[model samples]
Target: MAKAVWKGTLTFGLVSLPVALYPATESHAVRFHQLQRGTTDRVRQRRVNERTGEEVPFEDVVKGYELAEGEYVVVEPAELEELSPGRSRTIEIGGFADLAEIDPVLFDKTYYLGPADPATAKVYQLLVEALAHSRRAGIAVFAMRGKEYLTAVDSTDGLLELRTMHWADELRDPQQEVPDLPARRRDFNRTELATAEQLIEMLSVAWNPDDYHDTREERVRALVEAKAEGREVALSTGAEPEATELTDLVDVLRRSLAEARAARGTGPKGGRSGTAGGSGTAGTAGRPRTVGAAGTVRAAGRPGTAGRSETVGAAGTAGTAGTAGTAGAKGGPKRERARRAPEPPEAVEDLGSLTKAELYRRAAALGVPHRSTMTRDQLQYALKAAARPRRKLGKAS
Candidate 1:
């Protein structure tokens, strides 16, 4: 309504629906002033010439590519526009994709697609309704603001939303970045896998967006309040999934599949094992499954389902991914993480008769960083030293 970023005609088959591509989402993130710790003086950052230390204006800054140390190639805006790949007024429908192909990670910017002209409304509705009915996504290319974008168009609630995505090369190589993948794949077992899966199934349900919140974001706000009052901002060590590389891949995969199935509420008690095998994850509370002839087709090892199930942790709701169940929706590479729970605490010794607070203090003094994660009962034994610290076997009294 304010001003369209790019004006174009959405083309599907021979139908041309004139459309306005407007930004679909916005962030209301808060900003804060950087201040000196003791003086409360505001700290300011400036862009300056390295050699002269002269402050430079924002308009004077040019985008540059650094090829080597202290070496850069500055290119002008006009020159960049001249070399732009896709520059047109047409949103070309290159092809349609199974919605599952798109990875949530590759999604960059989203634009709401609306018919630009009154005459184009009919064809626009046709495309939107068709995509919604078929539950398919349109894989297309469009030129916007001198840049070419790979876009995915989905029709939701009578409006078409086009999401711009990253190219194949733009995505980072995970295989290169993560270490010890091979060794971690060697030692996993079936029982752990089954129990983990059972745990997931026992707790699985629908994804209500309201259920998830940025706890870190909320904590940051609380920290700000603490800072305003000049109180000790007690920091949380922050819960992170322990990274123990799996020693076995098969058990890893088996347990993961079971966990995902468990969250799926695909219990064999509710239905036959035959009905539950591949389709066990069907009937999730959020977004109903699009059943195929055999059953609901399962996407192998989706993101949250990775062996890193702890990544979602309590965020794992009882529901399915809704329309997002298809993992390969947009050429996003697929990888599986081995999801396993943390190991139990080591057994403690007897002769420990202290209050909980005192017991915790003893454990902290003994150098356990993960003490907070341990239960109070477990903490009691963890703090105990076996057999009253009996030094050497022969010299002990």
Candidate 2:
């Protein structure tokens, strides 16, 4: 069991319940130590007194606010703690609001909330049920580690989750920050718009997280292992392609649509009569493929479909099929099993066609897990699952 990061009283209305908060997520990034260049020695840092030129112990250091250049206002830790009497120990809910009304961008870190005392479990469960039923999040504020935080408490999968949020002022106006944004929508030929929309439809598919992985990490691991085993590593340099001109817009759309259709084994007529049960995608072949990466090929198509194969690229490290690329954990390539059936082309015209970022916003609103790392397909899958009603067990009819 993970230790709770915080223990406090959660008060809403006249009811008060002891609750504990635990971090809901963790980082999996590969960490590296700072090392001197061309040497194996590790680099380290220390806090020192500037004027005295001596290292300072943590216990002896006090926070000082610089009023002017050299003028300082020193405050003791005990004094700061005394400023907020019960705030550090209590989470007081101000009110409830529809979850949909809150912008997903404001949500920051997420934590799991549970009863701190075993006897208060019922109250905690009741709160979860109420929030789930009402589809509202409890807005609250609390202090921790000498800092106050704004949070939203909601329920997911019968569990209560608290998410820290950013203040409204923290958000920046895009008009001021972003450059070269189109002032107004440019009028394009209807035929061109239709072609582009059709192209998007041809490339649409269901989200599948299992189909993707961090290819860059895999490459880095492979490089390190290869050098350790005395294997030769080859590097490639490719020129960047020229940008597409505005006059070639329609032509590019038509070509891309045709290529996507052919890859899916569909004809130019846009029918779903391709190989691999019409589920196999071109280039990716259900399993994601990178343009320049591992030198391996795997059998393509979902189970119960015709056997087919596609060659993975062997050039440089680049060009992932989608959000992430699929590769084996070991040195050799691996075949992937297809888990989802192909959706009708009409799905492209639905919510499935939305960008991954847009889907993520929706997923955040629904308290979906792993939303930050989810691929576009995974986000769509999570959204569907969240919206699904749970099955109730009863006597067999």
Candidate 3:
């Protein structure tokens, strides 16, 4: 169980409920200490006077407001604390508005609100139910830790979730910050748009937060472990490819669609039929092949030709034709049973070949669980599992 960071009475109109706030999120980032290069000595930071070049004691350090260049107005800690917002036990709800009206960019840290006492549980549940039904968030102001905060409280799964918000002036305008950004609108062909939509549909899957993993943190941990084991680490210095202008939009869309279909196992196998390399026929004698859940096929040699003689499991494997299915005792044709097997666990590319940044992007897209604590191998495994097609359940008769 987690301890409550704040305890206060939440008030709205005539109703009031005692509530406790608990942090909803925590950081899992790896921490490092500063050290001198090629040495075991730790580098310590010290606050010193620039003029005297003498270290300042913690008790002597005071908050200083810079009035002008090289001039500061020093204020004692006790004086500053006295001037700050007074400690308040009440979170006064000033107004309520539609939750959707609030921009997500303005939201900051979130906290879970729970009943401070068993006697106040009923009022807390009442407020939560009201907010959930009304689809509105209560905007409030509260003083905590010598500072005042603007916050919004909304209902989430039968509980109140409070989020601290930034003032309007605090947010920076991207238009002002970014210079020479293209403002001209670009036109797209209808056919190309349709093809892109098809590609998106083929690649679309249900959102699952568990599928993502943070590979960078994992890499950092792995580096630390390797260094501890006295292992040498190799660094890559590959140049990034220059971006090329798209000459033919339709051709690019067509190629993308083809690749997407191939990945989904819906595209035609091999090249044009009777012209050279076609997947041949989908018969038992052709080649031993198995289809994955996502329609990916695995077989021996080329798609249209046979090669080695190896036993292929229902889980899809590359092998010879005779070994694919069981032959009947009376010289009967081999029965090729189409069984629902798990998708191949191999990644599209080796995890080691990708950079930590690239792995982190993939992990974010997949919504892997506990990604911040995962290692490179763990991230790779998680990504592979996330990329695998989900097994279809047979309809119950």
Top-scoring candidate (lDDT): 2
Tens-place lDDT per residue, model 2, 213-275, is 554566678888899899999865433344667886655545444335444554333222224
Q: Candidate 2, which segments miss by more than 4 Å at Cα?
A: 199-211, 235-242, 262-266, 269-397
Evaluated at residue 248, the lDDT of candidate 2 is: 62
- lDDT by residue (1-397, candidate 1, tens digit) is 4578888777778777788988876664557799999888999989999999999988888888999998999987667666744445788787897444455557788778888898767888888778766656788887766678888888767889898889978977655666643432424454455444444433333222343344456678888888889999767574444443556433333434433443344422332221232333422212222222222223222222211121222321223423222221112112222434422223433425555555555555444323443445545645543222211222212
Tens-place lDDT digits, model 3, residues 201-222: 5445433344334546777898
State which candidate, 2 or 3, has the greater lDDT.
2
Model 1 weakest 10-residue run by lDDT: 303-312
Scored by CA lDDT, what does every candidate get? 0.54, 0.60, 0.57
Error at 199, model 3, angstroms: 3.5
What TM-score does candidate 2 reach?
0.68
Give all TM-scores, in the order shown.
0.53, 0.68, 0.62
Q: Which TM-score value belongs to model 1?
A: 0.53
Model 1 score (lDDT):
0.54
Residue 253, candidate 1: Cα error in Å is 15
**Using TM-score as the measure, which candidate wins?**
2
Query: Which is the winner by TM-score between candidate 1 and candidate 2?
Result: 2
